[model samples]
Target: MALRRRALGLALGLVWGFAVMFSTLWLLFQGSSGEIISQLKYFYLGYTFGYEGAVIGFLWGFVDGFIFGVAVAWLYNYLSMKIYR
Candidate 1:
């Protein structure tokens, strides 16, 4: 079946964004520290290591996931068409 690119993109965006938001919040609550989390601060616009960071990470994750999902879905559809034909 052909993938619905827009719907998939939105779905992935929301899921990934919320996941990142919650995970970051959870880690902060647990007082966790890591290189990855620190590095993520650079990827997330306006992200720090606290409450505001979660919000900023969510937005960045959403945009990043949406673009990635769209590209992946398009590529999958293109490849599937080629293979089937």
Candidate 2:
């Protein structure tokens, strides 16, 4: 069966986006934002270690996850079709 790329992408994006937002906020409130900032900085340049940075990270994560999920679903659907055919 073919996967719905857009639906998969949106679902993944929202989940990942919110997860990043909530997790970052949690760390910030818990006074552990520094560690996450350092880690994210290593992966994402110009990432501030504050609320603004968390918001930016959330957006980036959402876009990244959405694209990834779409690609994965597309590839799976294509391969499955070929195999079944």
Tell me each candidate's TM-score. Answer: 0.88, 0.86
Q: Could you give candidate 2's per-residue lDDT for residues 3-85 as a string of tens digits?
A: 99999998898888777777778778888847645577676555667788778778877897899889999999999999999
- Any idea what lDDT model 1 has? 0.86
lDDT tens digits, residues 21-82, model 1?
A: 89889988888884467588777768777788889889988998899889989999999999
Worst 10 residues of 1 by lDDT: 34-43
- The collision pairs in model 2 are none
Q: List ranges where model 2 is wrong by over 4 Å.
A: none
RMSD of each: 1.4, 1.6
Which regions of candidate 1 are displaced past 4 Å? Answer: 33-35
The local distance difference test score of each candidate is 0.86, 0.80
